[model samples]
Target: MTKAAAVLDYRAQARRRLPPFLFEYLDGGSYAEVTLRRNVAVLEQLALRQRVLTDVSAIDLTTTLFGAAQSLPVMLAPIGLAGMNARRGEVQAIRAANAAGIPFCLSTVSVCPLAEVAAAATAPFWFQLYMIRDRGLVRALLDEARQLGCSALVFTVDMPVPGARYRDYRSGLAGASGLGGTLRRFGQAMTHPEWALDVGVRGRPHHLGNVAPALGDKTGLEDFLGWMRTNFDSSVTWRDLDFIRSHWQGPLIIKGILDPADAREAARTGADGIVVSNHGGRQLDGVPATADALPAIVDAVGDALTVLADGGVRSGLDVVKLMALGAKGVLLGRAWAYALAANGEAGVAHVLRLIEAEMRVAMALCGRTRIADIDRSMLVSTAFQRQDSL
Candidate 1:
C-alpha cells in the first residue's frame, strides 16, 4: 500500500501483481470497449461548479440507504471471479466496507461462501443474484440470504447472455479452449509467482463459492468462465419479479437498468430501488454511459424509488458527480477489485480512506456540507450523448 493514495495507483499495483489473464479479465470490457471508456471520460466532462466563502467549515459524507445509515454513500459492486484476485477477496472487501461504515454486496459467484462471509461480517451486507435457469436454486439462495441477514437483495437483470469479451479471448482467459488454452493459462500463472502463491496455489478448490452446491465439484477454472452462457435464463420477464419478492421481504433493488422506460417499469414493480447501470459497460459496448443515462432515469422515476448507479466511478469526486446526477449512491466495481488485488484488506481500506478524503475536499470546496446539498445545481451542463431529458 506504499504510495498508493488513489484508485489508479491501486489499479497499477493490481496489474503488476496479477497474471496477464486475470488482469485483462478484470480490466477489459466487451468488444471495442467504447462505452467502458465513455463511462469514465463522460463523467470527467461534467465540471463541478465550485463556490467560495460559505464559512469554510466541516463536511459530512453520511447518508441513509434502505433504512440503514452509513458513513459514505458507496457500496462494493458485485464482481464475478473477484475472489481469484486475492485469498478470500470478498471477505476482505466486506471487512473493509464494514470498517468504512458502508455496505458490501456479495456476488453469487464469490470466492468465499455465504456462510463464511456471514460469520466474518460484523454488520449486514447485501447479496446479488443473477437470473439463472434454476428457479429452485434461486429460491434456496434467497432463503439463505434471509437467514444470513442480508440488508438488501440486488437482482442483476442485464445479462441474459454474456458479452463478447474479445480481450479475454486474446489473453487466453476465454476463447482459448481445450488443453492448449489451459496450458497457456497455466504458463501465465507461473509467470506471476506472487499471485500464484496467494490465490492460485493457496486458494485451493478455487471455484465459485455460492454456486458450489449446484456445480458440485465437476468444474475447473475454464468451465467456471463459460458457465454463465448456459446457466443464465434469457426467458426471464417482469412477471418473474414475484418469485424474488415473495422470498425476499428485504429492500429489493433491481440493477442493470439504463433506460427511463425500464426505470419506470422497475418503479412499478414495487421495488425499493433501481440501479442505473450499463453492466459496468461489460454487457454491451456502445450503450450510453451510466452517467449519461442517470439523469433521465432519475427524472423518470423521481421519488418513486431510490436510484443508485455504477460504472466509471473511479474516485470520490466521481461519486459526487453521480450523486449530482441524482444517484442516491454509487457502486465501485473495478476500482475496488484493483484495490483488493493490489494489497488485500489493507488496500481496500486505504481506497475507502482515499474516497472519504477526496469526497470531503470536493464537497467542501463546492460549499456543500451535507450529502443532500449535492444536486444538479452544482454541475456545468454539456451536450449529453443521451437525447431524452426530463
Candidate 2:
C-alpha cells in the first residue's frame, strides 16, 4: 500500500541500494543462467482461472510444516554473508522471519555464529549444514546447533564444487589474490557509503563465528578466508548424510535435489523432507528448474516425504503454481535477500507482508478461500492444453 506496490519493486530498489558485487552475488545465476530464467518464466506462464462470487471473505493463509505451524506457506532461504548486507545482519533477518511467523534457515557460512543468532531469535529456526571436510568440526557445529535448540538441520548437498559466478570474477571481489583483492573490496565498500557506515562501521566483526573457534585465535578477515577454503568438504556423498543423522535428532531436510531418483534416495536416507532446488539455479547451469522438477520429486516420494521448492519464486502466484504442481512449501532466495539489502529488518518484514498480501489476493482471484483449497485443477499445462486444442 505504501507505493512499492509489488515484490519485484522492492527487488529493483534493492539493486540500486546494494553494491554491485553484493547485488550480483545475490541476483546472478550459473553460467548462461538458462535455468534461472526458466524458473521464473515457467511460473509466469502458468495461467490460473478466476472464479467469481465464491465466498472468498474468510481467506486463511496459515499452513504447517514438520509439525510447526506457519502464518504463511513461505520460508526464508539461507544466504551466507547476510551480515554484509545489514548490521548484525542474520539477527535482523531472523527477527523479521519470526515476526512474519515463518522459519529462517541459518546458513553455515553466516557471519554471526549460531549461538548469537539463536539468542536473538524468539522461535526455533532451521540450521543449514555445508558438510565441511573436517568431520570433527562438522560434529562440533551440529552440537552447537543442538545446544542452541535449532528445530531442524537442512543439509545442502548440491554444491560438490562451487558454481562459477562470472559477476564475482568481473567485480574481482573474492579476496583471493593478496593486497590487491583487499584494496578492490575496500573500494567496493566505499562505493556504498550508507552500507559502510551502518553494516561496516557499527556491525559486529564479520567473521564466520561457528568455524572461527576451530581456526584457532587468528581473528581477522584474512584468516577467516583461509579457514573457509581449508574446511568446505567438496567430496561429500549420500553416505555423509548418515554422519549428519547421527548427530541431530529432529526433522532433516536434504536441500539441492533435482532428480526424482535423488528425491527417493533422500527419503531412504531418512530425510523428513527434500527441497527441489538447483541451488536457486546457481549451482548447476543445466539442471532442471525447481518448478519443472518438483512434480516428479513429489510423485516419486508422494506422501513418504515432504516436498519443498525454491528458486525463482517471485510472487504469491508463483507459490500457488508450485503448490498446484505438488509442493507443500516454497523458499524465497534472492527475493528476500534483496529486501534485506534494501533496508535491513524492516525491508525484509515489508517483503513478507507484501508476499502474504499478494498470496491472499491471488488465492481469492483463483476462487480459493484457503491455501489447502488450491489444487492442480487450477493450472493447465500450456503444452498439454494446446495439444488438446489442436
Candidate 3:
C-alpha cells in the first residue's frame, strides 16, 4: 500500500486486486462515456492563477457544511456496492472519514446497513436516499437513518433508471445470467484470488444490507438487479420531495442537479444544499460536465443553498477549482472508492492526506490563506469568465 503513491496508483492497485467485473463497475461510466471524459477534461483545462508573494503562512482548510465543521471542503460521496470492493468496505470508509474529520454518506443500497455503519463509526454520518417505488420502504429507510443518528439526508434524484454502462455488460457485471455469463464471471473472479479470499470469502454479508427485508430471500446479484429494475420510480417528481421533507427534519441535500433551473427548484424545496453533479457521469451521457454545469448552478442558487460539486474530482486542485467556481464544497466518489478498494481503511486515510496536502499547496500558490477566500480570483480569467458565463 505504501507503494500506492497517488490516487491513480490506488486505482491501478484496485484494478489488480479486484475482479474485472467489480473494477469496471466502479470505474466505467454510461454509454460511450463522453460525459465521463468531459468531466475530467474540462476541469483539467481550467488554469489556476499563481501568486508569488502572498502571506499564505497559515492555511486553513476547515469548512462548515450544514452547520458541522469539516477538516476539508470534501465529503465521501455515496457509492453503492462499496463492500464488494473490500471486506466491510463501507464501514472501513466511514471510519476513515470520521478519523479525517469529514462526512461519509452511506448509500441506500450500501452493503452495510445504516445501524451497522453507525455503530462502527466514531461520529454521525450522512445518509443518501434513492427514490424507489415502494413508499413504505422509503419511509422505513428514512426512519432507520434518523434512528442511527445520521446528520443529513442526501436525496439523489438523477437515477430514474440505471444508466446503460457498456463496460458492465462486457465485463459480466450487469447481473449476467445463464451458463456462459456465469462461467465468464466466475473465471474473472478466479483470476483475482486475493479479492476472492478477502471480500468474497471473508466478507459474508455480500447483499444489500439496508433493504434486505424488503428484498427478502433474494440475495444474489441477479436478484438485486431485478429488484432495482422494478423498484426505481420513474414517475418520481418534485412533488415527491414534499413527502421526503415531511418525513425527515434534518439537513436535506438534493444531489444530481446539473441545470440551473433544477438548482433553483432544489432551493425552492428548502434543501439546505445541492450537489452539482451528473451522477459522476454515470447517469446521463452527452450532458455538460459537472465542472461545466457547476458555475451556472452556483450562480442560480449559491446564496440560497450550499452549492457542492462532484464528478471527475480526482485531485485537490480539482477540489479547489470547484470551490473557486462558487461551490461551497465538493464530494469525492471514485478517488475514495479506488483507495478503499486498494488498501481498505488505511488507503482511504492516505488519499485524504494526499488531497489535503495538494489543497494546501494549491491554496498557497493561488495566494489564498483560507478555504473561503478561494473564489474566482484564483482562476485564470480565460477559464473562469468563459465557463461562468456559459
Regions of model 2 farther than 4 Å from truth: 1-5, 215-230, 383-390
Q: Please, what are the lDDT tens digits per residue for candidate 3 over residues 40-143?
A: 88887888999988898999999999999999999999999999998989999999999999999999999988888999999889999999899999999999
Residue 265, model 1: lDDT of 94
Tell me the tens digit of each residue's lDDT in model 2 across 1-390.
Answer: 531345567678767766667677778887888778878767767777778888898899999999999999899989977877778889999999999999999999888889999999999999998878888888998999998999988899887667776766676655445677677767878888888788778986877777777767765555655666666778888888778889999999999989999998998988999888989778788777777788778889988889988988887778888988888999888777877888889989988888888888888888898878877888866775444321
> What is the Cα-based TM-score of model 1?
0.96
| Tens-digit lDDT string for candidate 1 (64-136) | 9999999999999998888889988888899999999999999988878788899989999999999889989
**lDDT of candidate 3?**
0.90
User: TM-scores, in order shown?
Assistant: 0.96, 0.93, 0.96
RMSD of 2: 2.7
Error of 2 at 353 (Å): 0.7
Clashing pairs in 1: none
What shift in Å separates residue 13 of candidate 1 from its native position after superposition?
1.5
In model 2, how large is the Cα lDDT of residue 172?
62
Ranking by lDDT: 3, 1, 2
- C-alpha lDDT values of all predictions: 0.88, 0.82, 0.90
TM-score of 3: 0.96
